[model samples]
Target chain A: MSSAEKPLIGHLVIVGVGLIGGSVSLALKKAGVVGHVTGVGRNRDNLELAQRIGIVDAWTHDVGEAVRDADVVLLAVPMSAYASVFAAMAKTLPEHAVVTDAGSTKQSTIIAANKFLPGPERFIAAHPIAGTEKSGAGAAFAELYEKRLCVITPVGDSSATALALVMQLWEKTGSRVVTMDAAEHDDFLASVSHLPHLAAFALVNAVRRQKSEGHDPFCFAAGGFRDFTRIASSSPEMWRDIALSNRDALLGQLDAFQQELNGMREALLADDADRLLKEFSAAREAREAWLAKHGDGL
Target chain B: MSSAEKPLIGHLVIVGVGLIGGSVSLALKKAGVVGHVTGVGRNRDNLELAQRIGIVDAWTHDVGEAVRDADVVLLAVPMSAYASVFAAMAKTLPEHAVVTDAGSTKQSTIIAANKFLPGPERFIAAHPIAGTEKSGAGAAFAELYEKRLCVITPVGDSSATALALVMQLWEKTGSRVVTMDAAEHDDFLASVSHLPHLAAFALVNAVRRQKSEGHDPFCFAAGGFRDFTRIASSSPEMWRDIALSNRDALLGQLDAFQQELNGMREALLADDADRLLKEFSAAREAREAWLAKHGDGL
Candidate 1:
């Protein structure tokens, strides 16, 4: 067979067959690079659905059994479950298998891998920067990762072969792979992703708290508020794990954001119209520039 | 002519014929409820474009000349310019003309109307809860207000005929008209519209502030961040006016939101995963309930 048509993975094991994992399986299968996909999750019904939908070739509830014969294992569970999942599969994981993850925070996942895996060098931490508010195996689609960015953060002892294979796997899924430091990835994501989610959640709660005396604030909420708080409808369990795992970086981001908000508050209280306009204008220009460059792909 | 086909407005004067005013003109023209539309704005090119695109039947730069013989005068300028615009047209405004506004904040517009209109009772203050991040006459469309909400907050002295005509004008644009107290409208809008804009602006600024040492936080921003900060790309001059006009209510919302954010921060700092999850889940539930009721319509 030509190299382009050769199967990159003989057997692929996905630890959590939710949106991210199911999408990866579908993308790889569509690319004809994976011979078989085994979805391993705690939810039996979800696993069955994944298999029925052809997202996976088979399903399993035991992590060790799934990883025992896996040529490549992708851990896509919530951050809180990563350590336990790692420990569960450590003993039975094939030595030849290259391990990777689709976690939001990389540093914590790397730490978990180092602590729980038989060979930490085989684990390549990655985060595909794409998702929707929707979750579950049913939300999975092959085009979910098309043209999206997947960040791979490798450590000092990472196996070059494993890293290359992981990069190639993500490339097969139509992602542009870039390597970054795990700590940097955590910090950057805190600013871009984690902090935005927290802000949306807090904004929703604040508006909800204002519903009093039969006056619903949400009644006046239109498109702007809907788009601003869309992420508030995301999976709370997954976000809670993400927030906890990236606590330090997220806290720093929160502090910076709070300071910025306080400045606006001060401008409003002082009736400083010029200050408010200047800040708002700067933000608009910055956002316009970003949009011009990135084209809002995701 | 039949009542439905008879023109509701013989001569419509639209001051500041940008997105909101131009859209209103186009919708009314499409509904066959307006005879002639006169577009007045500081930007000559935009007014010319509006006239050329049939958004208005005629174009003028002088508000006084435009409103001299009007059946209805719609002020669609920024909130900061309300008093000046009101004063500029007050002298030449026909005694029988019904003055209305498409301003963001009602209380301030009512105050401006009361202070500057020759006949305060003939002025009806309305806030059409519709728009895009785009501006200018080129962005105007007849269906811009379709399935949207337009709030009319009339003062006690507002003439009954004027209020009815103003409501009919909005209804022609396919908007559901709701009458609300001016103070309550400002408060509710602060919670939903104004505060969300501020949060988005503050978030963009916060991320911009983190651009140091060649690390751009915006580079890692994905779909969630893009949606959360979309309004930050809105007209700075317009949002500045809205924020300042609704200062007290917006400040209250900012305070409540800050408190909610602080609660989340405390939970994160204390490593209280349960607290974080509870808060996040509650926010998600509230947003979902709102979406269920409102269907995310603009």
Candidate 2:
């Protein structure tokens, strides 16, 4: 193979090979940048599915065994499992292996890596800002990260070589990589991702509570409600882990949103038409501006 | 022509020929059930566009003149314009004209008709639960209402013949017609539509407030945020009118939703992982059930 087409990773280990992890393996395979992928997960069936679908060259339930000869390792499990996963693979991880993750929250992963891994300096925290309401290996696809933003938050002691390799890994998946502080990443995600999911969950529950003996409010819910609540269908356990991992930032976002909503409720109660119009008009203008700038590709 | 192929209405007058009004006209025309459609709007340019696009065969700036020879008059204007439109068409409306509206809220339209129309009994309050986040005649299409729900709220004094004709009109556009109490329609729509819009608007504003000199929170927003806040891009003035018209019901919904959100906040604050999981799981289950039953067509 030409040097440009040479495999970037000799052996890749993917822990928790679900949507995010499996997609990374598939994407690397599609780019011909990985020699072999080892899928590690708690579920035997899912690991088998990943391998059968060619997302991984081999499958194993043992994380330590899977990462023993890895050139690069990706942790894509639920946030709640990060600590234990790190502990499981730390002792067996190769001295030269570069560790990274496709996590939603960066700071927590950084913390787990620093606490459990022998070579914390090699751990590059990343979050590919892409996914659907669906999960699991079956939902994984090579193009899942194409044209998406992958934010990398490097801790102070992070190895520059390892960071570059992790960056190249995501770039091979057709993602644009940007680096930011871990805390900043958490704050931004709280507003854009975590807050929206919580709002959706609350909205679905609110509508559900309104269901009485004769009236089913969902019967009248059409396109708008459907789209608004789509994220409520996402994995509850995964979201709970995210919420707890980024509790402070998420709680702050929720407070700000609650206050904004209360302002609207006050305007409605007081019959302040002009204020209501102004708030709604401002939101419409801002959203349109955002769509114009971003092109709505996501 | 055979009865099935025959025109249901000889002359149909549509006021405020925007998306909803224009779509109704186009669907009827496509079904060969409407003849000689007359478009009325404050904007001459939009009226001309509607006629040019064949959504209407004729155009007028005067509501009274347009409905003078009408077999059916459809008010598809903003809720704020309902009273004035009814007043304008009241005197010149043909005695046989069956007046109807494709408004978002039924109770408000019914009240406006009762207060301003010469033949209140002939006014049928209807809401076609279908549309995109688009406005104006240019965005309308013949297939907009197909396979959607059209809610009809017949007032106690509503004429049977007028109600039947209105139902037939929506049915011709391929809508599933259902009759409900005006107040009940308002309540259900508050939970499903009005409240969602307000929540979206609030969400956008909350995110916008997070913008600072070095950071624009919107830069990190992706597909989930886009879908969650899509309704925030709707017409502000139109939403303002709906909010005011459906004030009581929407306020009740807002209160319930706020309580639900606060409950989630409490769970997060207490670090009650089990409680958070339970709430999120319940929402996921309910939304999945709704999607299975409704087929997510919307």
Candidate 3:
């Protein structure tokens, strides 16, 4: 490989061989950015599938052994499992190893790293803002993160070397790296990602309850409802963990959204057509403008 | 044509030849179920385009002339213009003409028909539960209503002949016809269609408010948000009219949804992982099961 395409790390250990972890490995493998990738997970079938699909160079169940001599350790599991996973790696992580993560939330991940990682300065919390409703090793591909934004929220006192390594790792995978404060990242994501997911879940339950009253609407739920509730088919366990991990930010967003919803309800109740018209027109204009501006970025 | 494919009407007059109206004309014309289609609209350009595309055989700016010699009158204007359009057609409609509509809400249309039409029995209020986000004659297609549900709400003391003629018209266009009470149709549609639309609009405004405060969450919106807000980009004026016409039912739905949202907010505030998990998991399960059961129908 050319110097520009040289591997960034000697040995990399991925703690979860699922969608996010598997995709990261595949992207790095395609770019020749890692010397070797070890898949560490409890699911042997998933790990085997990842290795069979060429996402990892090998498979291992022992997280401690996998990170013993690794140059980079990536925690790619659910947020709820971060504490135990970090503790396991802390016991055997190499002295010079840099740590990173692909969790959706940042503040929780940083806290876990601070408590468990030997040198929390080596941990760079990252969230690659890209995924489908599907999960598991079977859903991974090298292009999953291509041209997607990967926000790297560097905790205070992070080592420059560790930050540079994490930044280069994502850039080589065709991701646009952006830096933001961990708290701000969590707050922003709570509105854009977490809140939307919860709203979809709530919508399905509301409609289902109505259906149980003998007025089934699913038969007429075509273009609009299908698209709107598509994410309601996402993994339940994953979403539950995300909701609990980012409780504060998610609750704040939910409150803001309730205020907006109440305003709409009041307009409808008071028969205020002008107010309803203004709200609907403004929303349509803003959404159309955003789509035009981010047509490619999205 | 075969006996089953026989023409259903002699001359069909379609007022407001936009997406719904234009599509009905095209579907009937392609099936050879109508002898001729006359398009009526304030926009001469749109009428001409509809005729040029063969959605209508001829065009007219005069509603009187269009319905004077017609055997069937299809009112496909926005809900807001129903009263005026109904009154205009009432003056010149042929005695034996079967009047029908393609409005979203039924109770309001039925009330308009009662007030404006000389013989309310001849006006069968109908709603074809199918459409794209697009509007205007240019976005119409011949198969837009194929296998779609068309709910016909027949007023008490209606003429059987007029109702039969209207049913035959939709059936000829490959639509599955079902009869429902006008009030019941309005209530069901409020939950499935109008409420979802309002929620989507409110969500966009809420996020936009945050963006104005310098934290733009839209930049991170992905597949879920795009699908959920796709309907937010629909015609604002049309939605405003629907919201007002079905004010009572829409308000009821808004209340129900608010209860659900408030429950979610409380769960998040209390950090009740179990409640959040239960809600998310139940929603995911129900949605997936619904999709499986209605896969082919949708």
Candidate 4:
């Protein structure tokens, strides 16, 4: 267990309690850090399920009312809904309440927070690099953030107390916390997460388009293709908002990836066996080294 | 156990005796389908290891010597070694022996066999669509082919007896067998297997090239990147040969993939959230459906 101090709070309100929000509630509740967890979501069934699973102490559809007494507020809604969610909560949120988010992109999230929330300095933007292809409150678990990396992107004028509280919250979830510039977080995640997802989606669509009269390519798709495109099965609605929210960074990542793909294509076209061998060898060595160091956690 | 009739062979000679070859030997030996298994490989240590592990009953360095009295011959060497292996075995191959292979690419293996062997009709080109990242005789197991798909590509004049024997052999290994034209097999595998492997390798290299000071993108790579690039850690040299051997089909796959990626890039650049959402939704639905049907096995 981590020796880091646990986040002490009376009421922790989680908006849009799906996998991320529900998981945060579960982890904090398990650590005995928070007195009570209030889950707010539009979906009644989902909220009921979260409460039934002990992921929340209470469930409600009223976001503003739920956070009236919250010491800390976690906005786990989709990026597309952040503006509306923030606008709804801004008017009723307690004056001293600290805010944080589990959004994948940090820059846009921070932007939304500044535009709607009165206490922008209290909003700490954090993205825990964790999750499976599975989503929803049903997929939430206390251990989802175990040994995961969490990046906190605090704005220039952000309150140190808010950032510290958010950092401690993630620490209680077993996440290693590191601070990064919001733009840097967006660019880094674009290359490692967003870009790979777009590639996987495109790869699957490519094969689907190539389906011939008598054959289904997917019938023969084995473990390699399955694992390689597993992310293609993630929430399309969630990913669409992400792709749009961090468009510029994602575009740069796509361009970088296109260059690599083009190089491999040219090597194959020219029948340059040596070049292909060298390229594949380098990738294999790098991936192996990373796996050796990380133990395949992600 | 399969209700299907088991393969019956006197002496089964498996060249290369690595994962694929050794697995076949193990599976057949467990089924009591072959009288004796003779392993052949350039590496003396590997051959001895296969024998010690009981994957093979005997070991030999000479392909011709091993196949002299064999009823079945499985060529499982790397694609680059096919021509040389075929040429060496052709001189002393028994007239009654049936030849088959576990090569990834069918057209090149068939071409090599036809060019070198007197009895091209006796060679049934096959690829059991199964494997792990692990390799060598030590990685071999009897259940490796259980419930996996095996594609057999027989030439127009391929001997019926040879094809039947090969089909029975795969069936006894617990594989679901399907026969297709060599060209069709190459194209199908190019879209499903080769293209995915290349994509994974390129994605890894793209991230590697973007490495900057104070940031290692891999440290933040989560489940999405891990599963999407798992195949990148596969055997590079073997994949290099597959890419080169099936160059034309793979190039076509690359072009198709490029088109899909370009479409995504356009959507992102245009800030077209609807198009991106539709694309991702379709991919997610398709992948989920495939998983539901195939159960994630190779």
Q: Model 2, range B1-298, lDDT digits (tens) per residue?
A: 2555657898999887888999999899888887689988888888888878889888988888888899999888888998899999888998988999988888878888889999999999899999887789999999999989999999788899999999999999999999999898998899989999999999999999898777688989998898899999888998999999999999999999999999999999999999999999999999999999885567
- Candidate 1 scores a C-alpha RMSD against the true structure in Å of 2.9
Candidate 2 per-residue C-alpha lDDT over A115-213 given as tens digits, one digit per residue, 9 for 90 to 100: 999999999999999887678999999999999999999988999999999999999999989999899899999998999999999999999988987
Q: Give the alpha carbon lDDT tens digit for every residue of A1-298 in model 1.
A: 2556658998999989999999999999898889889999989899989999999989989999889999999988888888899999999998899999999999889989999999999999999998876788999999989989899999999999999999999999999899989999899999999999999999999988889896798989988898999999888988999999999999999999999999999999999999999999999999999999886585
How many angstroms is the interface RMSD of candidate 2? 0.7
lDDT of 4 by residue, B123-181 (tens): 99999988876789999999999999999998899999899999999999999999988
lDDT of 3 at A296: 68
Q: What's the TM-score of each model vs. the native?
A: 0.91, 0.91, 0.95, 0.92
Computed on C-alpha atoms, the DockQ of candidate 1 is: 0.80
* Candidate 4 runs further than 4 Å off: A1-7, A35-37, A48-59, A133-139, A296-298, B1-8, B52-58, B296-298
By TM-score, rank the candidates, best first: 3, 4, 1, 2
Candidate 3 off by > 4 Å: A2-6, A212-214, B1-7, B212-215
Candidates ranked, most accurate by lDDT first = 1, 2, 4, 3
Error of 2 at A29 (Å): 4.6
Question: Which residue pairs in model 3 clash with each other?
Answer: none
In model 1, pairs of residues that clash are none
TM-score of 4: 0.92
Off by over 4 Å in 2: A1-10, A29-36, A52-54, A132-139, B1-11, B26-36, B52-54, B94-96, B138-143
Looking at candidate 1 chain A, the ten consecutive residues that score lowest on lDDT are A1-10
